[model samples]
Target: MRAQSGHDPFDLQFEADDDFGPSSDADWRPAGPAPSERREPVEDYSPAPRRRAEAFDDLDAPRPAGSVGDNPVHDMIASAEAAFGDHALPRITIHAFIERPRTGDMIEHAARDRRMERTSVTVRDGGLSAALLAYQNQPTPPLLVVECCAAAPELLAQLDQLAEVCDPGSKVVVLGAANDIALYRELMRRGVSEYLVPPLKPLQFVRSVSNLYADPSAPFLGRQIAFCGAKGGVGVSAIAHNIAYAISEGLGANAVLVDLDLPFGTAGLDFNQDPLQGVADALGEPDRLDPVLMDRMMARCGEKLSLFAAPASLDDDYNIPPEAFEEVTQKVRAAAPFVILDLPHVWTAWKRRILLSSDDLVIVATPDLASLRNTKNLVDLVRRARPNDTPPRLVLNQVGVPGRPEIAAKDFGEALGLIPALVVPFEPKLFGQAANNGQMLAELAPKAKTTEALAQLAQQISRREAPVAQKSSLLAGLLRRK
Candidate 1:
């Protein structure tokens, strides 16, 4: 296989010295990394703890997992890879005192990766405490790699103190000798970004922490297809929901269904049971969104299937500002392995934004003049607007009305110079019965022709095309023109 013109690949040389912590090692002549000091040594630094029992009881809780939207992990990796690529580089600031061998090797390992530019500063008396203070006062870098080796009790006490002053925004990877799960759980709960058992593997250390910014997921290796329709009676939501379910059940781990319609939207209703809360509540507070929150939000439909739904709430408006989506969607990406967004027809700013930003967009439509006119306008507008997005995936729904004349699927496809991805039949009984029963078509009528067609559509979307198209849809055109 040949490399893409602008792409390059490289390997890392890692060192497993995490006990003491990370450093640059420029000044001192190097010997093999220092052996982790004996943990059994007696503790000299001891003071009656200031913050008492209730503090430990109420302590560091994990960020709740977010609603598993689609393939959020892949989404995050692709985003990080694109946002902070190899050449763009991320600077890691390492502050450790004395010749901390374990921490020094970890920093050395970080330096080996293409993405990191690691720098170290050694302060004598400051030790872990001083390092924490200096880091607090200075502007935080993207990644902060620190090493502290105090007895279990003293190290934890100092970390508690360090947590008070450390920059919350900077990712902090802690290195310590005690391999206690209680301490590990406590550190993670307390917001120590990631905990490492000492004597960290060189490759594992560099790769693990560096992975925070790497795009390493299956979907990122392929395209993500999302479906939405023009208006309520347009059959768009039904099409979007069905296609996603089919993709999940039929296509395995290759597809996911997301119901972004918060208020009156139908994914939850379509599946039939109210989740305690959904994407609306999750996005309401992006800073706190994580794996734990996502797990709670997801309602599993199958082994490989999950749904990110709108709260079936009518009391509040679904309308929100545009920038809210950037993070909200990012959180969703971390949950699902395959993301299919079931966008509602309403053309608000963020709705248009999500449509335009999708890797693949499918506009589900009826074969009528209004649908054709709107679809064509949407095609033209999305192509022009994105200028960097894949062409919208064209889908013609309910092609032949029983008695009414409608445009031919080929003609509809030809007028737009794009083929209809799928042309679903007008089966009110089939669609209605399934919806009323809160069942997916695959389960309702596994052998149904509609189910087979949707399943095929999912297959095509997963095709791993290189240099993916970047285009906007008529959805965005509609937003701008309005």
Candidate 2:
């Protein structure tokens, strides 16, 4: 596991495409002659209108009519979802040299974005000249942003000089006051990542940086939803497993459920699986766990669902460090579209890290005094730790247990300032039968209310809608009856 501490951000390697760097053509310096000998007029370029059929010609050849890529609207929606999804920016440093205070302020605000939490950003007021001076003796960062107000020729000359000090593989983005397409193209030819005109929004700057590192060929990172109990015996594991199964089986999405409770996890028994290698093995050697190795360690529970079962043994000590868990989970997310983490009812540094970093968190608690206190504590910690994110969802489970004095769900929620997402009554028969039969609630009773609630929870966390059932017409119903 690589620790975020004790490392230089500039030394971090960015996974950029080979063509991302400047071209090797000798004429790549600039168009025409040297800046001192000749000057070219900058012309305003505007795109010509195209016929409806020709509009999409520049895009990839059309896919099958029913495929997602065939519809431009669907493609845009998918791109947005992937961009704002549960992925974080890679650990790298960005240095911005801006001559205007507004640009520097925008970049500073963009640096505080949640996706940029892992990145380090420094904003200076010196523009391109300052960058040239700074990087002359030191190494350039992975990404650099410089603002220049010069025209095409002067800007090109300055960039040509700046290129001498820039290290290989370092990407540069230019911010200027001009909107000339010719300048944009010339910058592209010179290996600049992007050129933006002024009046930039903070989110726009963040998205530009995000797009630079976006790989069209890389696997999509999955959304991770972690489930943990407010106290022991709150049935957190069962809820997590059911939701994961619902996401895969009901919503038709691929999902992976990881049991992080290495010593006493019940995922194997719940799914009736016995894999020799599981999460413990991956955590022990995170650097060696690639996609091929991950497939070998996972237990296939269904057509669309997989399980990373824990060893669940007491033969050896399981004093694994927190970094190992982080590294293993990061690898697992790339293998599926949705990941469910069934966290044990214990507090540690690793548990806190997972809770804070998860895309969505579900805290399950029974209706009681002790549960109330602990749930409030957890909620407060999450609220403070993740101010930019949505608050952790609260689930009041086993609300109406017989012969036990329990607090009302409304009162419990009022105390914590969070409304319960779902209030499930005490139903021992259904849960027990499902457990005894080694099946999920949906498998045992598909029409049950609790099963439906779990399915809804799955949809909520995954940000995906289940297929809607169409209503039959009256004529069709009559024909069928006849």
Candidate 3:
């Protein structure tokens, strides 16, 4: 199998419908619509009043026979539904002139995040001077981001020129490579919306734009859950897939499952969909990840479920930086109510950051010496790093495999000082069948012991029920019977 990297597997390309289109003359500049010269008299209306019972004016009164305000209750309900479900943010347009292609690429990817779907972005090569000349005679856009690599004094002088041509209501975000506090202070004093240093992460760029228009009273952002295995071949992928299924199918929330194991992810296989133009594509160019593009890239599994499948390829080495992954994950969180990350078992800096920063973490292991040692290490590290967060939930999978002399569930739990949230047995036939058929364990055998265990784990992580109400002895009971 060919290894796939961040290239768009399905070759999906997006082209914005430019309202300005093109110009016939090289010297032509945009001058908004010409002023109208004609005016018409405004029509006024006065409806004749009808004599009615005093009760007609009451708040509870039925509508008068033929008025436009008929069916007040239905109108009220419709209005409420519209307001309650409104997810569209205000339309913003970004024009960025960054000197570096890599920086420009990151900015473009952040521009296409779902939050900016209604926002139009055009990134070009140049700096503040280019931005100034482009808008010399034209109206400035809602948002303008420009970069300058000149020395501090020269940059300040160029920005003064930019400020002269900037219209009254436009917001400006400045980018530079200087580390001078005086320059940052000066930009703020000149009404610059924000000033960012070079080597910007995609998330940093996106957040700067988002904060400019954020409402203090808006609803809470989505929750993120990260899942990783104690060791490879320990069934972490299967567990992550099943839990994601529960969150979407059982809980009825819009869920996005992000398979981060780019080279060896199994979300597509487990969910039975083609892994084309998914997480890899989004991570490859975060600037193009708005709702419309993501909708096309994601595999719709069910009404409320979408899968950000990984491109399991060997042809390309997917060596993404930690910062890029962070930005992609945040944008994914912004796109859905719940996000589940299927992390691979690799002890790198990025992986450690992912595990430590998640809202919830699940570490899957089996009852063996290697799993136990690794689980203990991960648990201690997570606890020490995130003192305020609850400990990582332990899941013991493939327990009670015949003749494999495993540690007792009680002993394993005692050793780690954390009880097992889910203990699945070595039911090879059932798990294998489900994998081969591309179905979740719950779908294959609803009443099976393993399915029940998975459901419990889902409920715990989703906080649908109290953790104390859960039974951790499911596996121990099965083992005792044997």
* lDDT by residue (tens digit), candidate 1, 1-482: 11113321110121122242333344432223332334443221111232211211211111111112233433333343343222313454544342254345444433443333333323234456665677556655545555566655566666655555555365666666554444454556556666655444333344456556554552222234567674457788887777677666666564456677777778887888677777787777767877788778777777877777788678886556677765667566655556788876777788776766666678888888788888878877775553223356667777666998998887777787666667788888898999999998888998988887776666556532223355889899899998
On the 0 to 100 scale, the lDDT of residue 439 in model 1 is: 90
Cα lDDT for residue 95, candidate 3: 85
- Candidate 1: regions farther than 4 A off: 1-224, 254-256, 464-482
Q: What is the lDDT of residue 438 in candidate 1?
A: 96
**Highest-scoring model, TM-score:** 2
How well does candidate 2 score on lDDT at residue 174? 91
lDDT per residue, candidate 2, 272-329, as tens digits?
Answer: 8899999999988889999999999999999999999999998868888999999899
Best candidate according to lDDT: 2
Q: Please provide, for model 3 over 1-482, each residue's C-alpha lDDT reduced to its tens digit, 9 standing for 90 to 100.
A: 01124432212232112122222443422122221222122211111122211211232222221123344542332233223222334787778887666667666555544445578899888878888789889978888888876666677667666767777678888876554454555566667888877435443456567777778686544667899899999999999999988777776778899998989998899989995588888888887787788888899988988999999988778877788787788778777878899998788887887787676788899999999999999988875564323467778889999999899988888887766767888989998999999999878998887777677677656645323454769899999899
lDDT of each: 0.58, 0.76, 0.70
Please give the lDDT score for candidate 1: 0.58
**What is residue 413's positional error in candidate 3, in angstroms?**
1.2
